[model samples]
Target: MWRELAAIGRETSTGGYRRYAWTAADTDCRSWFRDQAGARGLSHETDRNGNQWAWLGDPAAGDAVVTGSHLDSVPDGGAFDGPLGVVSAFAALDELRSRGAEFTRPLGIVNFGDEEGARFGLACVGSRLTSGQLTREKAYALTDADGITLPGAMEAAGHDPGAIGPDPGRLARIGAFVELHVEQGRALDLSGDRVGIASAIWPHGRWRFDFRGEANHAGTTRLADRRDPMPAYAETVLAARRAAELAGAVATFGKIAVEPNGVNAIPSLVRAWLDSRAADRATLDTVVAEIERAARDRARSDGVDLSVVRESFTPVVEFGHALRDELNRLLGGRVPVLATGAGHDAGILSAAVPTAMLFVRNPTGVSHSPAEFAAEDDCAAGVLALADVLEGLACR
Candidate 1:
């Protein structure tokens, strides 16, 4: 499964994949999913919000157990972040079929679109929209880096933008959701285990900062004569790190856009994105407030205009206790409990339906980059673990 998807989107020289949402490559993946479902004789359908689902039995039947994850990637993201859960679902089905496991309930493998929010700047957009967490109008108004409206992109991609909205009918059919993913850090590795159970996802959010100043020729503008917002923006970036460190939060200024984008011109507008996560709501708020205060002070001193807008915010989520405990029991209580700094579509679905996550050990203890990795044995272990859970949930 890794090799199958690795061959799709562009691969960086660093060995990472760049499968942005709603692009040709993502479309290719959706097609690939149809092929996979066709080969398995599982009927598939695309939801109003672009999520794809392949069902083993009648979807109108009683609530079904759902598994799988997104196929999209962050720019040059690691191989396993979103794809692991998806591939493991396929593998688990293969495992179940080979063993002739009896099934009394319907099962589903779902592929959610844009889980990373790498393009739309809204994480879990598909799940959020499907569950009514975000309004259709608000989703349509979202803009990409190139200023393409999300609705326009949907239309260009052969989808009805007007059809994008909450899907309570679909949500109601899901009995539970299980997402298997590569651990973003070393929690499982430290325990000498192949898998871990996610206890919760820390409260997280994305904020955009727009700083405006006078644009001037870099060579002609003197430091004392110019009011450049770049310095203030840079200072705010550094301040985010300092504040996160002090508050024990995770903050990153990973995306930015500078107007004129040239070495010989002073940027009149600087837009930067801040991704932050913390243990609780208060800590997260305090850290973001500190970062904003720093940016405001810097902008004041530099005589520049600064504005901050929160693109999205997800509250800290604890996986449904019953399902989590069941997974722990199924794994023989060897799985470690860990809270993730990263967000997942499972976190979003947790609010609407019971959701849980299984994390395979990553040796590099890194993610969102080329350095992320998992041992083959660990991946196989994750597949086996998922199959065990599926047997209990979907099999007679």
Candidate 2:
């Protein structure tokens, strides 16, 4: 499994992996999934929104037990974030077969697209659309850093953008969703546990800031006369930090681009993106509002035009209590229940169906980069936990 993931990693130039949706790397990973599912004799189909589902039984079976996750990765993202869930789902099936476990209800392994939103600027694109959590028009208009609209990219990738929308009928087939993901934070490590059940996902959202000013020669432009955007941009970043700190949440100004970026040119515009998250909706809203106010104030004082647009917003999600209890019971012990700040396909799907998550320990307590890790033993433990849960759920 590591070898397969490493192959995908090798195809990327940004350190770890960059399998953005509809990109060559993502397409290759999709093919890899098809090959794996075929080898297992599972019938496979791609939904209208491009989600891939491989089934072990009849498709018409109502409420099929489903497990899996996304395959796309952030730029230079670690090997485990998305792929571990997929690899573990396949491995769990193998483990079940080895143990001769039988099921009454159908079982499905799915590969949700664009969970990272690295290309389209909207996370959980497949799951959210399929679950009716996101609208078609909003999704189609989303653009990447290169300014290519999502619809154009979808067309380029041979998927009809017009087909994207709420898929309640398709989602009705899933009785429950259980996603296995590498723990992206220190919670599991602090608890000293190999496996955990997710209780909730912290509220989170993304915003884009565009600051416009006059471009001028760096050497000739007098400091007093210059209407440079960099100062306003810098103030906005600082405001974000201060606001997040005051609100007791987290905020990041990670992506920035300066127009006329030449060393000898004063930038005419500065564009930055902010990712903000908090334990509750109120805090998240407060932090975002504060940052936006600060940005506008700075822009006005600096004679720079400003625009702030919300890219995506996912409220704090509480996993199905019944499903979580079942998973805990299957483990035969008090599996710690934890909440994550990270957004996931499971979080999006929870709006449509009973959804839960199992997190494998990340020794590094890190994700979205090459340094993320899960031990071989921990990986195997995750499969066992998944198998146990699947057996219990499928038998119901």
Candidate 3:
């Protein structure tokens, strides 16, 4: 399975990956999924939001048991983050079939679109829309780095943006959702476990900062006469770092671009994206407010106009405890309960369904980069854990 993922990774040269939703790479990945599902004799369908679901039984069955994850990756992202769950889901299904475990309730495997928000600036787009967590109009208005509106992208991808909305009819069919993902942090490594169950996801949000200033020739323009926004941008980056440290949260200025980005030109504008997260809503709010204040102050001192726009916000999510207990029981206490700071489709689905997650240990305790890893043994362990959970949920 890792070989298949690695093969896909070899096709991209961008630092991690650039498989934004609806992009060529993403489309290719979707095709790969379709072929895989078809080979397994699973019936597949694409929902209005572009999410793909493959079923092992009757699709009309209400409250079907579902599992799977996204295929998109962050730029130059590691091979495991989203695809691991998906590959493991397939592996588990194969294992179940090999064991001849007859399942009465319907079983589904899904691949949610734009879960990384790498293209449209909104994570979990498909799941959020399907679960009524986000409105379609707002989703349509979202734009990519190149200013392509989400609606246009959707249409180009052969999905009607007008058709995107809460998919109650589709959602009603899912009784529970269980996602198996690679641990994005050091929790499992610190705890000495190969597999763990997720207890919650930290509150998180993304914000975009636009700083406007005068664009001028870098070589001819005197530094004092330039109203370049770069200074303010730099200050904002430092301020975000300081603010996050003070608030005991995480704030990152990972994406930035300068208009007229020429070595011989002073940028007219600077755009930066911030991803912030914390244990609770209050801390998240405080961190965001402080970052905004710092940006405003920096902009004023630097004489650059500024504006902030919220891209997405997801509050801390607590998974169903009853489900967690059941999973633990099924796993025989071998798998530990863990909390994640990363965002997930499961977090959005939790609003409308009983959602849970199982995380496989990353020996390196790192994620979102090419360095991320999960041992083969741990991968198989995760599959076993997922199968156990699915069996219990399906039986119940």
Ten residues in sequence with the least summed lDDT for candidate 3: 9-18
Better of 2 and 3 by lDDT: 2
Models ranked on lDDT: 1, 2, 3
**Model 2 residue 45 lDDT score:** 88
Instruction: Report, for all candidates in order, the number of backbone clashes.
Output: 0, 0, 7
Between the candidate structures 1 and 3, which one is better when assessed by TM-score? 1
**Compared with the true structure, what per-residue lDDT tens digits does model 3 show for residues 268-372?**
989999999999999999988998998899889878999999988998999999877878998887677888899999999898888899999998887878778
What order do candidates take by TM-score, descending?
1, 2, 3
Pairs of colliding residues, candidate 2: none
Misplaced by over 4 Å in model 2 are 9-14
Query: Which candidate number has the best lDDT?
Result: 1
lDDT minimum window of 10 residues, candidate 2: 6-15
Q: TM-score for each prediction?
A: 0.98, 0.97, 0.95
Q: What is the C-alpha lDDT profile of model 1 across 1-396, one tens digit per residue? A: 667777788585768878888899889989988888888999999988989999999979957999999999998888889888998998999999999998888999999999998888898889999999989989988898799998888788888778888898888898989999999988788888898899999999999999999899999988987879999999999999999999999899998899888899998999999999999999999999999999999999988999999989999999988999999988787778899988999999899999999999998798988777888899999999999999988885
